[model samples]
Target: MNPVVEQMNRRRSVRNFSGKPVDEVHLGRILLAAQQAPTSINGQQISLVVTRNKETIARIAEIAGGQPQVAGAEVFVTVVIDYHRTREALKSVGAEQVIAQSAEGLMVGATDAGIMLNALQTAAESFGYGTTAIGGIRNDPQAMIELLGLPAETFPLVGTTIGVADDASLAQVKPRVPLATFAHMERYDAEAVRRGVAEYDRQLRLWWDEQGLTQMPSYSESTAQYYSRVYFPKVAESLESQGFEFRDD
Candidate 1:
């Protein structure tokens, strides 16, 4: 088996870290890894702002609803979905007029930003460093944009904090559903999907209970509750307030 494959299988989110710092050499390699990720249309719209400043880290932790692990990480990197670079690239090549008139370019920028983040996470894990992705950073987009000096149309999507893990900070790998549940044959099988979820829900509830967490409701119920209780409304408001016009044809 390939070393990278093994690493991929073992990857888990780490929200705790040691006092030790990540060396600059490894940090540069991680940036390189992000740059190497495949981008939509080669748009390469991701931008990263690295911060080692304690004050800035503190602010990010606060903005992320006070995730203490974030404040103590050795380095923080804010990943942004950026349109400024794309806009400038188009202008330099005399394509600005056409590109600016279409939202296609903007969509590509956002997709590439997501690709870059996954690359960064993989790179950090491969190098034996711990990382925690801070999605709540999006909750205070306006403040983060100002703090990071982001130009209009450029926005912080999320951030990742990285450091070596302390002995006591090691985390267990959480179990996911068996491949048979999601890896299906050629055509979609609705019944199989439904049955799979039933089995997985049992597995999940058992795991959660063992970990001293509350039992899950039925899979569909839990799925609906997650979005209704935590996701969609906030996301919709964020996009609208950030000036992203929703267009339905």
Candidate 2:
């Protein structure tokens, strides 16, 4: 496998850090990778804020449902979907700004944010840094906006913590569903998914059993444990609170 793809394929959540700050020079390279990521319509509707402020990191951790990885992180990068710059440019030129009010617009920003995050993680890992994406940030979008001082047309997309990995926190990579389950060859493969579901559950249980975690639940059960309950209600409120309009029904 190619080195780049290998770096990307090693997807594990690093929840422990060494409490050491990252080198600004290396961080600059990661940020560059993020900036170079492709965005929809060349709009570049994204911005990232990097900080080492202990207090801010702690607050973000609290806001993210007490994620210790965030609380202990030496570097935290806040990625947001920012239409503010484009809005200002449009206003200055007396052009109508409407994309910020629809489902497609949000999709563009979120997709760009995701791409940028992948680039960030790959680049950071290349420098021997550990990283984890915090989806819990969506639980309190209002707090994120106020804490980050994000302007209208700017909304939190995701967060990342980068630091030296603690040896103990380095766990084995978790298994994922088979490639044929998701990556169809030029078409959707419903049958592949039907077959892969139980296979992945078994694979997950075997992995857990190897770790002496016999009581651990299967993939579908674990997934349902989270998905069965409604989560991130704040995310919906964010559409209105953050100056976004959602029209898709």
Candidate 3:
């Protein structure tokens, strides 16, 4: 197998860190990789706030719903979908209409942030560091904005924790749904989606059992439960408070 492909295949979310500091040189390279990720129309609306401060990390861990890795990792990079810079740039060029209040602008900023974060993750992994993306950063977007002193037209998108993986962090690769499940040809196929998810649920249950885990639920059930019970209940209000408007016009 190609080395890159092998590396990707072996990638897993590492929640336990060995407490070793990431090298400064490696950190610089990882930041450069993140900057090299493509942006929409070269807008470059993504910004990263790198933190190694113990107290701040601890506070962030608390904000992240008590995820220890957020505080224990060697470094934490908070990815921000930032339109403040672009809006200023537009003003600099004498463009009066600079506010990014549209859905397209929000999506572009978020997509750019995601791309940069993925690049950062890949770079960290290439340097033999373990990383996990933390969506819990959005658990309290308002608090994050205040704590980080983020300006207007900016919002926390996600976070990445990087560190040397502890021995216990080396777990088996988690299974994903079959490619045909989401990768459509020309038209959407409902039957294929159902079949693929059913098969994937069975495979996931088996994988969970092999790992000495019980009480595994089907993918559809788990997904529905999570969205209906956990995520959706809070996300909309948070996003709206952060100045995101999901306008259909």
Candidate topping lDDT? 2
lDDT of 3 at 189: 90
Q: Alpha-carbon error at 195 in model 1, in Å? A: 2.1
Error of 1 at 155 (Å): 1.6
Query: Which run of 10 residues does model 1 get worst, by summed lDDT?
Result: 96-105
Scanning candidate 3 in windows of ten residues, the lowest lDDT window is: 229-238
Tell me the tens digit of each residue's lDDT in model 1 across 1-249: 899998888887787787887989999999987888987767767889998998999998887778898898989889887667777887797874333224664566567767777788889888899887788787777777778888855678888888898768565676676676578778777787778887877887777677666754645577877676655235445554545543422
Model 2 lDDT at residue 45: 92
Model 1's C-alpha root-mean-square deviation from the true structure amounts to 2.8
TM-score of 2: 0.95
Candidate 3 ranges beyond 4 A from true positions: 230-242
Question: What's the CA error at residue 121 for candidate 3, in Å?
Answer: 0.6
Give candidate 3's whole-model lDDT: 0.85
For each candidate in the order shown, give its overall lDDT on alpha carbons: 0.76, 0.89, 0.85
TM-score winner between candidates 2 and 3:
2
| TM-score (all chains, Cα) for each model | 0.86, 0.95, 0.93
- Cα lDDT of candidate 1 equals 0.76
RMSD of each: 2.8, 1.5, 1.8
